[model samples]
Target chain A: MTDEAFEQALINLTETMYRVCYAQLRQKADREDAVQEALKKAWEKRRLLRDESALKPWLVRILINECHNIQRKNRRVIPTEDVMPPPPPEDADGVMHDLILALPEKYRMPVLMIFMEGMNGTEVARALRIPPGTVHSRVHKARQILKSQWEEAQKE
Target chain B: MKQFPDDLSRAFGRADKEFVYQVQCTVKKLSEEKRKERTMNKKIPFGVVLFLAILLLAMGTAIALTIHNWKHIETAMDIAVENGAYWEWSLNAKIRLIEAMAEDGLAVSEGDMAALKGDDLTEDEKQELADRILTEQYGEEHFIYYYTIAVAEWGEPQTWTLEQRYWFFKTEREKGLYLDNSWIDLLPEETDLTRDEVVRIAREAVRSAYGMTDEEIESYAPNVSFFITDVCDTPRWMVEFYTQGEDGQIHGSPYSVLLTRDGEVTEDWENLGVLTPAQARLRQERQKETAVDVFTMRGQMRLQDQNTVFWNPEGGKHYHFLADCPMVNADKLPLKELPVWDAQFGLLTPCPCCVSLQDFWSLKDKLRYDVGSWKYPGPDWISEEEAVEKARAALEEEGCSPEGLYPAVYSTGALEEEDRYIVYFDALLTDPDGFTGVDPIYYAIVDACSGEVVSCGESESNG
Candidate 1:
């Protein structure tokens, strides 16, 4: 493919990639960071993806891993600014977004792949290199967390 | 969570665009740095190879001379005796011993081990001595060939066998080691070279050997031609000459030749530098064309067919082409004829680099397919008559009202808004210092389509 065509492919993949990252991390800043990091890695290893047909899958896989890595690192750094009142109701839906970020990485990854990207549970399992049953359970646990968090926020 | 954020998709899209843009910018910067790094890496390997070659050549010449001269051999042997001969020896230890002893004033005859054991030598010395004896018995050629081989293998000097003798003589003559008086030793009669009669005879002998009638060698070489003119006890003939385009004259220096006595070449007959006038002129005519060198304007280029087009990629100006010009890969055609079709056929998809013939054919094949139609347009041929008509129309369209328009105009086969191939030209210019000097005028081709020059001519501007 021509260099211009390859660039167009990158453009097409960017939106889906951003959604996957956002679903996994639940923060606009973190999703953007994850997308940028994933795209950079794909660009650096572009030669390995000479088969342009595989570029989207390749980029999506990388974005998922990068999201997981960022989540793991964020969890290790315990927040010190604490004992404050609940976050303000700015973008009301932003609360669900914040709760998604707080969810365990395992659950968040499957929900992001299944809901945001509309990938099947089996595809999510394959992407994560895990069993389809594990992916189904992760998605189930992610929905439970979101439902519970939404109820708590409503009560508040 | 909290009704699960409906506007998350919109935010995601905006963030995605920003992220892609940032990543693209970073990739562009990294690409430039990586290109520079690759260029530097390419030069390092070539430079290392060149340096190693030069070092080997110098070492070989030094070793060869040391081995050939018995005095150096004696000194080396003394050092070997004082120290251990095979201190740094390995698989070739046996060979080194044979060669060293043969050089150490040892006769090296068969069964001469008993004769060689007069001094209590180290294991290295004993081995070297034994090897020398074996070489003496088995090897021939007065140990000269052995020295040559040793120099070649160890020192790696770059010179053909035919040139070695001349190199040796020239080097020795320059050092004032060889003298003209040595030639008198080859004289049968009692000839006093200093006297008038002997000097006349010596001059006569030189004339006869060089096939010159009465013309002296001095007027030939140093003054006019490639002839050597260095004065020494031993003299050699060197003839040199070249053509002067301004004067339209063929000039040359005289040929220098060693004057031999009784047909025998001695140390004094080492060099007879200079050439006769006739020989100088002959050499001049031969070298005249070769002396013409063209210097190129680095990165500045012009196409042959297009005059107004010029480019300088280094200067950072790109003039978009009116139409893409395809440079034909002339090598693909048979020697009998140039590849006229490709030369005249401009490619629709012109890359920054020259159009490869294989790419042209591949493109042509793909033009009928859906993928090919979307990527590359085809059929870039302009007929001779149609091109002429177009040129006339273009000239008329400009309202120049010229008496005649050249029918040989070309079309850069691109849409009206598409970029055209820059016209590039190769030109020759006289050196600023003038033609009498060593360097010649520069030659170069400028790409006029874009301001960037594609290729440049050879440079001989070093004054």
Candidate 2:
């Protein structure tokens, strides 16, 4: 696809793509920065896309990569105390959001695509360049881990 | 008036909408900018391939420069060296011969295949084998996997007396631990902790769970393969201790250790792969990310909401990213709506013994929680998060808080799900009551997703 055509395709889905970026980055500013960087990268490598329809996944991949880059470079500072705090109440959705955000990169991308973005395991695999079965297993494992943690919180 | 959490959910939705809009605007600007940049790079297809070719050439040159490593071997190996040119030709010929013979459903004997080596196989015979290899072996995941096993040797210098053998094997099925130090560490069987430690942990866990005495534990421990290795670098000790469960099926509990050597443990104590709650919260990130990819070929076969356009491999276009390609919607579906055919996932055929993909995907809560879990293990590698946590705790116990620390989780849960979790932050360690508001933690879940605060607070002003 031509660079202009690719840009146009991405632009058409700009809103949705933005939502995905926002969901990932959390911070509006970071999301904007990530999406912007992703767009530029995608546009510059338009020919690499091969087909116009592949734009979404390609761009999503780029966007996620950009978020990683941003986090890596910024190096957020977390405070550490030796004391053990009381456990928080169970809030499935809230905890899910936090835990999803806490996941490692490999699981996060595939998990996001499968659950939040509402893509199937197959589509997630394609976008991540992983096999469908791996995606399925990862999702299953991710869910299992989440369930275990959730159960842990409830017990506490 | 009782208000529901849905109201907060709406606010979150608004935030999401605004965030999305903000990103779109930035994306538009960046795309325009990249358009200008692309004019310079000039859109080359297989550009990476070209770059890789150049890289390989450089590597080859480097190898060629190092002649001493090629110095020792047998005269037969020397003959192989003298016949380097011939062998190269022969290897190519063999590849062609194999490719051709793949067509037929016949496995030629070594003698016959060797006889055909100097170019004796008819084109038809070659084609048949090639077809057969492609159809039978190449089609199977294991074949492609096993085919990857290879031994490679750099080409010997022309002055060398013996051929320096370099074997390159590629296979689809991998046998060894898929950890980074795989080059240094041998298989699990070869590891130092493979037998004793693994057995100890496994036996301890089993004995505690089953209320077995030391004698019984010792007997079971030797029978089981209990040992731990630096397979994933996590403090993970693979507890392969097993015995006949209540169901009569031989079952094993492979516990992943999240605790430190100094920490006390009881069978009732929770194991989240960490010594403390803070460490667990911090280390869980690594556990999530280092998750191994056991089954190859990840892609969704179902569409979300059934619109299908958002995630169809047969859609307008397909990207190389596995997740971006075709996907089957596994959630929010009726049992009957599940796709009957999936090229990749279809391998998970239903068994009379258990649930099928259809059954699993269609069940209540979108998973067969009632059925037995897949007894397989998790990823073999440790997350950097866990490593960092271990490093930090070592620092803290040693009073190295000034070093400041970062935390990570192993895997991220799927998006859109309501997963609940609680991370413990100790007041004794750092009084939240004394601190300001939420602690500014530089945290992240997955490399793919950003991190958000679960909870951070100072205690209510020392009432």
Candidate 3:
């Protein structure tokens, strides 16, 4: 692809890329590092994209892999004391953000892609390399968890 | 189908401008790599390759000749150096080598090397020369020595296996040449402490110093290593323990102790002071900068209201802001939150160690409480208003404007043992709308009893 075309594609998908990356990695530094690494890898392997339509899913897959690599390396080292969960937000709107983040890793990404990134079920499956049925099931399960947490918070 | 809430969609808009800058930087770097690759693809002509080969060949030949000539001179000196020019040249080379080695902290005396010269030397003379060099260097009675001959092959030095010999020197009776130094045994197995004993001594020292229980000591599993220091003139064990400090950093503190063969501690152990005051201040500054960067990336102006102010109403003595503050016990979960008015009215003092509060209230006329003990005068100290005023004054002295900052005050109540109350306040920078800025939150601590400043500095958070 030409440099101008590549830059345009990147600018159009910046928000989607960031949401996907932030959903996987919590820390700001880790998110930035993962996105930069993913972009470089995508540029290096740009020739492999036979069709321009496949670019978004391919980039998302590379980014998810980079985030996983960072998480794996972090697990091997002794965690510093500052690696605590972000403090809970006090506002009503922020409750959903925290609940989605609190969801288990397996369900969090699919929920984020469908809801936050506005991707369809098939697109999420393609990006994650999973069956479309699996993506639907994960989204359903994540919503159930969020519903229960929301209900419990309301009762309190 | 359920969809993401509007708030959740808006949260995605919180992307930092720094991310875009980082992506552009990466693209620029990749483009530079592509340009370099294109330049490198150009082919080199055969004439250049042939010229480079010829140049390398000439350099190799010169190096080989130099090595060959040096080897011949050294061999002649070993056998018999009757020619005056050759003798003087060999002696000068030997002197230069010894001088260079001495400058590199490996001393070799000229007398020792001179004694080994001359091919007519007897075996006894050679043994005496080796003994003198070893004794001068190691201050030991016995030593193992070896010498090898190097032969030139294709401009490279290869070991001459047939001429290599080893010698062991102790007394005149034990002095003999062999094929290798392996024949000489140097292990002082009986005089050294066992590994298990060293570990036990190190563990005991750590436990006593830190007041740690047996379970806590076992879980930490301090690392112990053995080394021989001349101060002890024997092997001693160095023990290091990794502990979480008040500043939320894992610090390794090492202690060195000398132990006898019988596992008795012969000398008092000394703890290595790792972090100085300047180092602590530097670390705090770095952490504050990192926190500011993170806040800016997240587009957050300040911490949650209830999250920043922590209080234990039942204890009713102190108020804390930072979750990792050292004054609060690690096991104390779910710290209670208090309103700004209640926290200020109760006259609760802030922790000195965590908040870096200056002791504003001196306890000269008031009763003081001794830490870790209940043996002291009653808790009599300054009022809440006085503590707050003193803290504000301290921040003002540090060039903080009250009009542009929101002040959060916390305090530790009067302790009979300490003889004073400690007040701490965080001077958070805010715009006209009461929104916090990216600047560091200044903190000040004061002694409530005498209204004297105890300590003052900046923390990573508003606390």
Candidate 4:
């Protein structure tokens, strides 16, 4: 693909890349690191990308891998004091958002893509390297869990 | 308030405007590279090949004779010495090798890769950049990470974890330590404390935690491995205690305590690492209780309309820094979001298991906590007196008087595989009014361990 076309495609998905990255990494600096790393990786290996249509989901996969890389760093480096200091939940919406964050990674990722960013099963499967069937099943199980909890909050 | 899916999406979908702008800049910057790859796809025409073959055939005999004489090893060496033909070739070859490596993924940053792969940079500029990247910043992060790991793994370094950098340096490069003293630039394991003292500190920490005596601790058979925690970073000891809990009790397996060279426990990791069947079940039961605590806290906040925060309200317990944060429960609520002010965070403590939140503490905080000398550990070999004695002898041999000279030594030559005890002799003159001045007459470079006086001369200040 031409550089201009690649540039336009990536530009169009700026918000999407942001949403997916932010969902996995809460810290702004980490999110920025993940994005920059993913973009650089994508640019260097753009030739390996055989299909133009796969660019968006391809970028998502790169971003997800980078986020996991940042998270895996917890095991190796010495952590510092002070909280990550997530902005406090103002209302039920914020609380629900934290619930999604709280979900185990397998469920949290699909939930963010399918419900949050409106990505369909095919895109998620391609991005996550899972079959479409598995994507829907995980999303279904996650939704059931979220639904029961949301109902409890509504009653409260 | 919105309903289930909408409310959740509302929270997760929102990205701060600055984040969106940052992504824009990054993507735009990456997309502008003039990709110079895809050379293999170009097809060569038979006509061009035939013309080149005919041209070479016409001058083939003369070209072969010229090449055969010059390519000989002895002749090549002579040519290199006479003029500088071989020197230019050697330098150009190294620069080309660097470019090839960078193109193959040694270059961590986007600009390095772009400059090597594009037609934008002149030959001089490319050579200069490659030299700077190769020799400069040897002890900094991201410098040799990809190159070292790629050489070790022979696979893609980009896909590898950041931990691999330290792993390669600590274990894989141990054999190469003597072969090349290049590790000196990256190692500042300078501490006055002996290995025995550091081990004792670790042993005491384990003994106190398990409530065991030294003999009892010996039964567990604790093992220690020294490694760099961060690449181009400080050296740490990963002390692991082998065996499991007694009588099928659940305990931290291969229990580990990370300690600094200055003997400070980085965190309170009384429990961490893998889990056995019994340990998993016990952890589940413990989580059930935490879930209940969080559930009650959440309900109270909902009912009272309180602006709550989420933490282990307990002052001494660890707050998880990982994605699998311990506050989140499988069967129940996530965190019991509390309402503690930033000023009231006196009780919160750092996690011993995952000391991952580096940004939370500033560099000043790290320095204060780490407290390592970060000097070369050459003093461990020979004593200061030995170095001074060698220096005094060298001075005496040179017919120089040592009557008024007091010797001082340092280990600053390790950077060049020359870990020499550089001793300087000083003569001080004290005035009657209590003022004093000092003079240095001679200096000596004594081999740290071998006790050889490598070089001895007058002090630079004396001249």
Candidate number of the best lDDT: 4
Off by over 4 Å in 2: A2-5, A15-26, A76-96, A102-105, A120-122, A146-156, B1-18, B30-463
Off by over 4 Å in 4: A50-52, A75-85, A88-92, B1-3, B6-8, B33-463
DockQ of each: 0.05, 0.07, 0.08, 0.13
Task: Please rank every candidate by TM-score, starting with the best.
Answer: 4, 3, 2, 1
Off by over 4 Å in 3: A50-52, A76-83, A87-93, A154-156, B1-7, B39-463
Per-residue lDDT tens digits of candidate 1, residues B207-234? 6766666655322212111112223322
Fnat per model, in the order given?
0.09, 0.12, 0.18, 0.36
lDDT of 2 by residue, B67-118 (tens): 3322212211322223221112233343443433332323545664564454
| Each prediction's TM-score versus the true structure | 0.27, 0.29, 0.31, 0.33
The lDDT per prediction is: 0.39, 0.37, 0.48, 0.51
lDDT tens per residue, model 3, A62-84 = 78988886564332111113435
- For model 1, the stretches where C-alpha displacement exceeds 4 angstroms are A20-37, A47-53, A67-80, A83-92, A151-156, B1-20, B27-463
Candidate order by DockQ, decreasing, is: 4, 3, 2, 1
Candidate scoring better on TM-score of 1 and 3: 3
Docking quality (DockQ) of candidate 3:
0.08
Model 4 TM-score is 0.33
By summed lDDT, the worst window of 10 consecutive residues in model 1 chain B runs over: B293-302
Query: What interface RMSD does each of the candidate structures achieve?
Result: 25.5, 14.8, 21.1, 18.9
